[model samples]
Target: MSEAVARHWRSGHVDVEFLPVGAGSYHWRASTPKRPPLFVTVDDLDRKPFLGADADTVYARLRSALETARALRQSGMEFVVAPIEGRDGNVLSRIGRRYALAVYPYLGEPRAFGNALTAEERVALKAMLVRLHAAPKAVASLPRSVPAEVPFRRELELALDSVNTAWEDDQYSRAARPLLAANAAAIRGWLERFDELVRISSADNVDVVITHGEPHSGNIVRSGTHFALVDWDTVGLAPRERDLWLVGGGEPQLCELYRLRWRLDDLSSSVRVLLSPHDPDGDPERALRVLRISIEREPFTRD
Candidate 1:
């Protein structure tokens, strides 16, 4: 990994240290004598979020997404902490067939996931999101648009339908089948409500903009005087609510629509992981926990 960074970034004698931080991706902090310290991110393109996308396809879209972010940052949007381009000018570099790499200026300011947002932070984040929503470059450059339906929705349906059958794929899949069966009815109702929300929101003319799809505290940080956002991997052209719902200050119905969108995305992805063969590096257990909570928790219940 250090060799790859040095080769691509043209930095000599990189010192790479693994940082176990984000879910579904590998991170490292790399330093060199010639340039400032950099943050490195590597992802397995064949799993979870990129399951259906082959390496080349995911690479193209991710490169475009990060480029959009770079454009936003260059536009003087201080909150956009975009990717640092490689020597070849592409935003991402292929790491064999299964993985890809990207680099960024190391912020070294990671906020803990699930930490409660203070009132001041909430206000600042809301204002930052408002500025992001109005940026025209995001709409013009985004390669992928936020889908109206929850991600992994089809896989979730298949899991629910196959819950009664024995899953011989693996121990985790076998265990997951029964658990899914127990909550099949409630899960179906949740999907129906999600679709209903989609119908209602679709009828209203909501402005679509570049969204930092997961703008939770873990992704937003205080950069000097401004609150900057990181993790531009999920950036896309979407409704303002796609980002706003998490931060509050939006309409109750719209916020609830997206809040449900978030959970359903979580539940569906977890179910898909358990139903199929997946990476076991703490992912299966995490998926199981998300599946368990998602099924038991009532819809519209705030955490």
Candidate 2:
């Protein structure tokens, strides 16, 4: 993989040392002479396409993000970390048949927003969201908003089926079976409420904008003295609430400050927690514990 990355970097006439950085994606720190270090990410385009977007869709989204980032920076917002064009003038390069690569100037360590964000950081983040939301629609058009509860309901059904099937014969299910039975009532109630919320939100025609999608603190990096957002993979148009929910988690003051016109009452943070994907190969006992806690502590209620 490093060799492939080196070859790709040579195409741009950039001589740099690639050092493996961290997990999640194939990340590396590229050191170059006469320029700041660059952070490069290479991944299997076939297996891990950007946010499950097809090639054409992924390219269009990246192009739009790059354009928006440049425009935002030119408008005196230096904190926007846009992708740099390769020697071929493309923001993303197709490597072989299975791989795609993108490069950005290395930003410093990401800020950890543990538990809650500080008042000053919240103000800075709010300012950034205002600028992003106000930017002109750079992408041709945004993707249609799918109801969040659709997948949640599907997964809940699958989980219920799995638990039922396991109870029939699997020894591993012994630990989780009782827990599942205990929470069966609560799970069903949450599912019904989730379905209703989805129906209500889906029926409303809401305004959309180019959102950072997942703009939590982990994605916000502090480079030099300023903060810039990374991971444009999820960049697309959706209700401002999509991004606002990440920052405020339904906090009224922050949402109002951002001037969000859409209501987030239906989209609780617990929905994501409840519908989190489970690994088939993972430990069943551990998974049961997680599900138990998540369902027990869920904030949803039949009000």
Candidate 3:
């Protein structure tokens, strides 16, 4: 038994104890003076994990995130409540078979964004973003994480091919084709002007700040005075613009207003690339190409 593994299974850092949860991730039982027992999750320790990627890579990236969070914690910024590694809340702990452990401050009454954040809360959200992006060296010193950036057109094309040639899910095949056909011109235009789009998207490239790669309203938690960001697992380096993209992309009405909040002067015409049908017979290569394009969109964002 590795010492690290033994320590994690027996008793976790501080008083928090861990329990294993299956699936590419694990969970732990933890408590703090101010909060009661709660569960925190860590990614799986497999050599190759989700989406057919190396598990070690993901593990390392997550560890790096914890380190970054710790450094950020020291800077008087507290948007994210990251898990501390060891007893002293300094070192991150590696846990069971292939998992890691961290303690989350349990919410007495966890408030979801839709319920908690009103129109005013949206202002608070943007303010939190500004503070998060302005963390100076905190995010800079951390690793860069980017989604694969294959051109949206290429991805759609491949996805179309998959629909035609492969045994894919019928629903995805049917829905995506018409969507692509209708949006082909817009999609191709965005692709042809990719660089221009990037430039325009990044006009307010105020800072390449740390961000939660998967930023949906789901990841936010509401506390008394301020909102706390949970799930730092997807933390990575990204253009500050990305912090606002999902909000606008998911909700178009907010596009113009969200841009102003993030201080972006222009909004790049957006396109959602349907890489490949996620069917039983789908080609992974098509998915990979789409992944590459997603990565290319923002060169500096990496994990």
Q: Which candidate has the top score in TM-score? A: 1
The models' CA-based lDDT, in order, is: 0.77, 0.53, 0.49
Model 2 vs. true fold: TM: 0.68
List, residue by residue over 1-303, the lDDT tens digit for candidate 1.
Answer: 899998988566889999978877789999888677898999777653542456667767777778888888888787888888888887888888888899988888466676767787888888888888788753456547766567788989988887777775777777678888887897788788888888777764766677777888778788777678888877777677777777667666767788888788878888777765654544677788777777676543323
* lDDT, residue 215, candidate 3: 49
TM-score ranking from best candidate downward: 1, 2, 3
Best by lDDT: 1
Candidate 3 lDDT by residue in tens digits, 1-303: 223433542344335455543323555555535445655565655522312245556567767777776667667777767664555544456555466555455553333332334565566667777677777774567856543233233444454344344334454344445544554565445444553444444545334567655445556666677776666665666565556654332223223222332221111101121333453433444433443333243421211
Worst 10 residues of 3 by lDDT: 262-271
lDDT of 2 by residue, 70-124 (tens): 5555566677787776666666776665566777787754344323455655677
In lDDT terms, how accurate is model 2? 0.53
Clashes of 3: 24
lDDT head-to-head 2 vs 3, winner: 2
**What's the lDDT for residue 65 in model 1?**
76
- Relative to the true structure, candidate 3 reaches a TM of 0.60
- Pull out the clashing pairs in model 1: none
